[model samples]
Target: MTIHRAHIAGAALASALSMTSSANAQALEYQNTSGGSVTVYGQLNFGYLNFDDGESTTDEIVDNDNSPSRVGMALVQPFGDNQLRFRFETALGLRSSSGISQTEVPDGIDWDRTNIRHFDFAWANPNYGTISLGQGSMATDGVTGADDSGTDVISNVSVSDIAGSFAFRDSTGALTGVELSDAFSTFDGGRRGRIRWDSPEVANFTFSVAHGTEILDEDADTDYTDLAVRYGNDFGDFNVNAALGARRIQPSGSDDEDYVIGSVAVHHAPTGLSFAVAAGSEDGGGDYYYAKLGYARDFFAVGTTAFSIDYYEGDDINGAGTSSDSVGFSVVQSLDSANSEIFATYREYSYSDGTATSYQDANATMIGARWKF
Candidate 1:
C-alpha cells in the first residue's frame, strides 16, 4: 500500500531528531506564609485541517478538539496533614475540528456555560485520600486513556475529534448522512456535576467512585454513577499504568445503560519505546478495541520528539450490525523553552452500515501547535 508523503516526512524528521531530554512548562502561581496558594494555567491549540470525503475535500483552520484551548485557576490551602482545594476552568469556545462539517463552518467564538470544565472543591489528606464536589470528572473519566507515548498532544483513541462532523460518502459519491462521530465512540466517561471519593493509594493502586448528573443541561434528567480503579508503578527501567472502570447511566424515564472500559500502557524509558491498548463495551450495544505503538527521544537540546501510530475498530457503534475503523499516524516536536509543541497527524476512517451499498473511506490531516502557560 502507498503511504502518504506527509507521514513519511514526519517519520524522517523524527529519525533525524532522535539524539536528546524532556522538559515541561510551569503554570503561574502565588503562595502565602500559611502554605496557601493560587495558580493560573491555560493552553492554546490551533491547527490547519484538510479532510477528504471520497468525493469532495474541505480545508480550514480549526481548534484541535483533542485538547482544546482553555484557561483555569486552582487554589489550595494546607493545614496539618489535610488540604483543601478549589478549581475553576472553562473552554474558550472557539470553532473546533470536531464541530465543523462538510457543509457548514461556524462563524466565530461562542462561549457559553457549557464551556465550563470544572467548578470543583475538594479536601484531601495523605491518610484519607480525597473527596470532591461540584462540576468535575466522573470516576471513569480517562479510565480507557492510559498512555505514556508523549504523542497525545496530537493523537489518541478519541479518533473522531479530528473530523467528527464530516459525513461519509457512498460508492456513488453521495453523502450517506452518517457522520463519523455517530459511528465512532470510546464509551469513556466525562465530567458532570458530581460528588466523588478516591481512596488512598495502596500497593500502587487506587479506587474511585462517583455519582453525578447533567447540571449544565437545564432540561436534561440523567444520572451517572461509576467506579474506577487505577494503578501506576515504575520498575527499574520500565513504567506502567493501567485502569479499569464501569459506569451506569439512568435517564428519568428510560431504561438504564451500562458500560465497562479498561486500558493499559507500558513504556521502556531507556529505549524510548511504548505501547498501549484499550477496550470497552456498552451493555447490549457496541464494543471497541484500540491500540498504539510509539517512540520518543530527546532529539534536540530543546526537548523530546515523539511519534506514534494507532488503530481502532468497533462493532455496532452507530446501530446494530454496523462497523467503524480507523488508522492514524502522529508526531509531536517539543520546544522546551517556549513550553510548546508543533505536531501533525493523519487518519483514515472506514465504516459499513451492514447494507448492500458500499461506502468510501474518509481521510483527514491536521498540522497544529499547542502552547501551555
Candidate 2:
C-alpha cells in the first residue's frame, strides 16, 4: 500500500486539531506520521523429496529447493519528485529437520534459517540512478546466471537448498564417508552488507559496482568487490538479456581469488521458448558452466505450464582437483488465482576426484508447491 506524504501530513494536522476540539466527532487516523506506506509481502515454498545415493534412499519434506521462502516489508517515501526506499526482508525456515528453536537457528544460511536477506535504504531518481547502503545484495547478486527460462523455479544453476545433507557414497553403496565437495556451488554472487550503486539504464544497458567486507560467511570472511553490466532489449518476438560480472575476494587467511562470470539468456514470446547459458572461471584454475532450456505456454485453463532441462559442471575447485556434475529436468505450472505454483523435478548428480574414478553418484525427485504474495 502506498500513501502520499502530503496526504499524511494533512491528516496529521487534522487529527491534531480534532484532538484540541473536545466536541469534534470526526477523527483522523494519522495523528503522528512521517509520511509513507509499508507493504508486506512473502513467499512460502516446500517440496516432498525422494533422494537416492545408490547406497540408501530417503524421503522427506524440504523447503526452498526451488526458491527460498521469505517475508519482507518495503517502505516508500516521496521527497519531491524523487523517492527514498527502505526494505527489510528475511528468510523463514518454516520446517526445521534439526529440531532447534527458532532463536538458535544459525545466521547467513540461505535455507533452514531465519536469515536476514535485506535491510537497506536507497535513493532513486528516474533520470539520475540509484544508490543503496546497508545490508543488501551486491552488484552481481544474480547476474552470473540471469535466466529468462520459466522453469528456473525448479531447474537452474544453483545448488539445491538441502544439498548439504546429501552425502557421497562408494559404488557398493557404502558411505565413502566423504561429504560432498563444496565445489558443486556455481558462485553466482549473493547478498552482502555493502554499498552499491546502479547506473540508470541507457540504451538498455546498466552498470553496477559494490564493495563489502563480508558477503557470505560460508567460507573464510573476505573483503569483496564486484562489478557488473547488464543489457536487455527486444527484437521483434525475440527478447534478449545478458550480464557480465567480475568479483575479487581477498580471504582473511587464504589465497586471494578473482572470478569473471558471464551469462546470456534469450526468450521467444510467441513460441514460449527460452534458453540460457552461464559460465565462470576463477584465477586459481577453478571454473563452472551451466545451461538451461525451457518452454512455457498456457496449456491449462488455470495458468501457464513450463518445462525445462538444465545442466551444470564444476571442475578443479580451489586447487583441490574436485569436480561435480548435475543434470535435471522440471515441470512447473502457475496458478494465477492463488498466486502459487505446482512443480515437479528430477536430477542426477556425480562427483569425482582428480582421478577419473567416480567417487559418488546420486539422484533425486521432488514434487512441490510455492505460494507468493
RMSD of each: 9.3, 7.6
**Over all chains combined, what TM-score does candidate 2 have?**
0.83
Regions of candidate 2 where Cα sits further than 4 Å from its true position: 1-36, 95-114, 177-181, 215-220, 318-320
Model 1, residue 55: C-alpha shift (Å): 0.7
TM-score against truth, every candidate = 0.92, 0.83
- Judged by lDDT against the true structure, how good is candidate 1? 0.89
Q: Give the per-residue lDDT digits (tens) of candidate 1, residues 254-293.
A: 9999999999999999999999999999999999999999
Error of 1 at 257 (Å): 0.8
- By how many angstroms RMSD does model 1 differ from the true structure? 9.3
lDDT of 2 by residue, 1-373 (tens): 1124333543454454442212212212221144555555667777777777776677666665447666666667778767798887777745422221112333323452226789899998888889999878888888866777777766777744444446677666566544443546666668888989899999999999999865445654788899999999999999999999999888788888788888999999999999999998887678989888989999898999999998888887535677778888889999987778999888888887775546667877878888775
